[model samples]
Target: MERIASVDEIPTKGVLFDYKEGPFDEQGILVRTRDGFKAFKNECRHLPMRLDDREPADIWDPHGRYLVCNSHGARYRPDDGLCVSGPCEGSHLKELPVVVKGDEVYLETDKIGGFFNV
Candidate 1:
């Protein structure tokens, strides 16, 4: 397991990208949803392009409902990383297995699925 970010760094309703320089490889995100922290690959399902153009938390839709893909307006459910509406509808984001211990967020690097290819 690799600690990525502290729980205080991520808001309860915001998201943050784990830079490549961190313990994890490749671009990934840690979202603080209503339920709790959820992680996923930063790549959009449409292509290898990144999903957020700016800060991850500011890339939501007009109503600030879903996570909107800045490149294509692909709205995804932060709770499950599911693309409910967009060119890639029905597809889902590659979720990362994460666990929060104390005040730090960590990812089970060794258990990352092959879909990430990290």
Candidate 2:
């Protein structure tokens, strides 16, 4: 059930896709890091707000290490899915398991909530 995307479809940094239905109500930003492709639920743990409120852009930190919630200054490390700051310090970015097959990227839709405790 992984949603596949071509390498061209995804930017070198990352791309945001809106997930209005299915398991995720909010959008998810997929990043192409040194490790591999990764995605996270695009909502801030604090105040239950969308992370990209003002800019409506994909959530990404200047350092490229974490996706940032600019609204409340929350930072989520893309590597291990940890919130390093803000009210949701102990919380983590909802991880979306993904795989890159050849030039396509797919998300494991079946295990969305169950695996990540979403």
**CA lDDT, every model vs. true structure:** 0.74, 0.71
Per-residue lDDT of candidate 2, residues 5-24 (tens digit): 68788866677765533454
lDDT of 1 by residue, 1-118 (tens): 7777788888654655554424445777778777778888888898777787645535667776677788877878988999998899988888888899999888776686322322
lDDT of predicted model 1: 0.74
Instruction: Tell me the TM-score of model 2.
Output: 0.77
CA deviation > 4 Å runs, candidate 1: 19-25, 53-57, 113-118
